[model samples]
Target: MKTLILFVALVGYTQALSYSDVLEEEWNRFQLDYTKFYQTEDEALLRRLIFVDNKRRIDKHNRRFMAGKESYEMGVNQFTDLLPKEFQSQMLSSLNITEAEGLIDFRYTAPRDVDPPSSIDWRARGAVTPVMDQGENCGSCWAFATTGTLEGQTFLKTGRLVSLSEQNLIDCSNDAPYYNEGCKGGLELNALMYIMHKGIDTESSYPYRGTQQKCRFNSSNIGASVEAFIGVSGEANLAAATAFHGPVSVRVDSEGMQSYKGGVYNNPNCSDEILDHAMVVVGYGNDKSGGDYWLVKNSWGTTWGENGYIRMSRNRNNQCGIATIAVFPIV
Candidate 1:
């Protein structure tokens, strides 16, 4: 009887030890997987795990990865001293700038009626057009976004749409007292200001081969021009957007935008503040679901959003910063 009792106790102890060993192995494996996954910082995987599972573990990892990427890019730019001297001064001054947080509330204003015949439609006026992209791996979004809007406006006004070089703004705009390097973000307003003051040339005159190049200023044939800059207030901007025929520049929170799939994103329940990023507003209308959405064009490749664009909720001032910033009609 004594021997049997001792044997039973030993077996139980061994089984418990084996179970602990298995658990420890799993924990280590999970740690390894997480490190490798986040090291690459794949946006698609982060979106899938974050939205589908609401996995807090993965969310923490994603934020770390994004921070790492931002830090790495900033460090590289700093080491190389890639930005123009003038832009660095401006970026340092604007470091504390932040956009409004939470949902914005306002009334929609009816759009102004501009006669179609009297105005030139840039979209219809051109046979060939320049392709635009979001400045990924670089903080040159302001340069790209502003150049795109001007390109369209130039086409409408002059009936000749020329591909304006972004490299000019990247290198030359630094001459302004407030400009920053391509690593730190900048405002589209400043970009336009640079064009009006310095005079921007055509892409052929100053091509964007990427990387920092010598400053080339050709004041003689600065192809395009800006008529005016119209600032919109609150949610009312949506109504103002529909009336315009050409592109309008606006800000948006693009942090999680990398993973957005097809859906009418309406979550008044989120607690965290959204990050502000700029994008072009191309068109707006109601969709098949009988819900109104704004047709927005993004800089990320077409595979990212609804073919490089998204139809955000028009009624709510979320998704893109629809209620914030100003939209202008290039007269």
Candidate 2:
């Protein structure tokens, strides 16, 4: 009987060690997979991986990346609450949680029905800029989109043109909690709100690093200040286009964006699901096709679209709340 008991103990110890080994192996694989996935242009698998419910699998991957750091411990509790309950358990069982919260939220809103600025010159509009591609494993899109729009608008306003740093908004912006970190998804209006409330520092003051870091406080504010905010009901009104002179923040669908490669995108077959991504409308007019399109500045990078912007069809009643919240920058 003693011999049998000893044998059982040995087996249990081996089982425990095997479990540990499996986790270590999986952790290594997770890192390699993540790097390869991000570096390559192939997004078919990535789109599947990101949109699917794989909280536990992702938690393990995050743990491996954040191993041996103080942030890891903090991530343990934070990630638990952030992941769905089922995923939390699966991740905790195999790996230590390091980074818990996702940056993007599907729900948020801007102030409603404000008028757009009228100073915008539709004739002066330039070619669509390149698409700004936000690499995977990062969530600085809000800052990028905000800065991208600001850059175009500034170019239209001054004609000198300057590339505003999205990284500034990612790191700085004290108006909203999510703005503090680019890891969490944020809205363009939030950046505008910060600019209006606190004033913005120049791109030279705050450069775009493409990653999250500590914020540098500026003593002098530079961007236009907003006096009031209003909500509009539909997209057909000329008021929506007028708001472009100021910051007109709008939300649109961005799910299949990973595959977007430039075109007059107006596919009725595509899903109508709208993403929380925001952009600034620099100008609007009837395209050569006579279809009304809003000249939108994007943050993906200059390599993607018409330079770095897209011409989305407007007048669908602001289908996804694109015309809902328009803010005029107090000139």
Candidate 3:
């Protein structure tokens, strides 16, 4: 009896070791896939631990999805290693728009009175450029969002889809009246106003460095210039504006998107009062099973969500502030 008990204990110890080995292998593979390089061994170990914990949560969430208890699925991506707070501070911008700022006066023009189509996709209309990756530790989503709206407007006007420079806004747009603080954080309205004043440069002329630097904006290489901007509110108005205009810049609470993989995303934690990340509304449609969803383009890269896009819950009382602050530039 004593021998049998000892053998059982040994088997349990071996099983624990096997589980540890598998987790280590997974950590190694994740690092290799993402090209993650840690500056110190201690940092790498801490990241590995965080990765394991995140993986566990992701697996549990997926299980719930499989059981039809959840609408969306969560999976591992580049953000699996970072803690939630760390991810928010690094990726999301600190949006501090006062109530007065929210009030759009003469600038906010309603779209032409016409019923919008059942669905609309700006990408299919030869407007949207390819998805872009905003590198880690940078809160410059506002720049990307602003550029996307301008890129669409430019295409519609010039019959050419030219990618504009987010780096230009990041480096040059931080000043009075339009204070876009480069990677630290910024606002789409401010970036758009800066472009309206000083025409933007092309992405090829001024490439993205993922960091703020000395302004290298050249007026000679102007890619697109914004004449003015129009703001709209409410689900019906946002849809109408997107259908008539090109992609619209909007803000949302992006905390729920850290590990988002696929499916129509909806989280109770998402609120319009805490809009932290900016993105572009490329299209909107209804998922029969998932209900209505707004197809949004994120700047986190092609590997992040549905090829750098997310289908956010739409027409559900303005989930994630999709209609709270929507604006589009007129090129």
Candidate 4:
């Protein structure tokens, strides 16, 4: 009987150690420090903490990629295990869309060149386009998108690049007339409206905390303002916005964006009118393969595609809603 009890104890210990080994492997595969999740060395608890569902999703992702079911590349990413589907929705479509917001029009202009530049990357053109930002666990992507466009406009107007504060909008816009959802989510139009009424402060003054907090805006410390913001809903308008102004904020259906590691993402399941995730169109460009693509700046940080950028397939009937819900702030 004692020998049997000792054998059971040994088996239990081996099982616990196995769980810890798998957990540690997954943690390292995700490139995340387990210390960030928890400092405790309780292997059993850590095994339960790891997202098993993501393991399932990762398996499916790899299967589809291997079978040529995905148009884009897939890899173990920062968000691979940390985010769930509901979290993805919160990250993308936190804004309540309204007709009033969509009907706003622009006095559109045609591209000066009969053939627009084959490649235009504002990042290389010396704009105060801020470095790629990480929204982290917060649903503050709307604020990041707003601040990105504001920075572009600020650069165009002052010839100086300034990294503006998304936190200022997240913390303060709740009381503003724009009906901001605060950190939960917000619309670019409402953000622009908030900026028009009350100018936004700089990142230095009110840095991003990646979560909602109390309003602490000092009107006296305003960093940027827009002369006006116009909304457009087509490929021609997006082209005009990029050529006439700088980067423009737009939304597209981010159905399969979570696993998007690299490549010209062309998802058939993506929605064109159901605008969800907000990003910026810095310019339109072509790849070396002669394929046309839109140069977009994402707020998912430098670790994401093309170093915080995504080259989206362009002129494909506004593929992924790239043409729909396009708006820009003019400084």
Clashing pairs in 3: none
Name the lDDT of candidate 1.
Answer: 0.51
Residue 183, candidate 3: C-alpha displacement in angstroms: 0.4
The per-prediction tally of clashing pairs is: 5, 30, 0, 1
Candidate 4: 10-residue stretch with minimal lDDT: 30-39
lDDT of 4 at 257: 73
Q: What TM-score does prediction 2 earn?
A: 0.54
Q: Report how far residue 195 has shifted in candidate 4, in Å.
A: 1.0
| Candidate 1 local lDDT, 177-295, one digit each (tens) | 53645535666666676676676888778876445557887877576665555555454454454344466666655433344444443334321234345566555666555266665
Query: In model 1, where do residues sit more than 4 Å from their true spots?
Result: 1-131, 261-275, 318-320, 329-331
lDDT of each: 0.51, 0.48, 0.87, 0.73
Residues 211-316 of candidate 4 have per-residue lDDT tens digits of: 7889889887789997788776678767767866788888888777775677677676677877768888888876654257888888877677767777788877
Best by TM-score: 3
Higher-TM-score candidate of 3 and 4: 3
RMSD in Å for candidate 1, one decimal? Answer: 12.6
Q: List candidate 4 segments past 4 Å from native.
A: 1-24, 31-71, 100-114, 132-134, 288-290
Candidate 2: residue 190 Cα off by (Å) = 2.8
Q: Which one is best on lDDT?
A: 3
List runs of model 2 lying over 4 Å from the truth. Answer: 1-135, 148-162, 174-181, 220-230, 238-240, 243-247, 269-273, 288-290, 317-321, 326-328
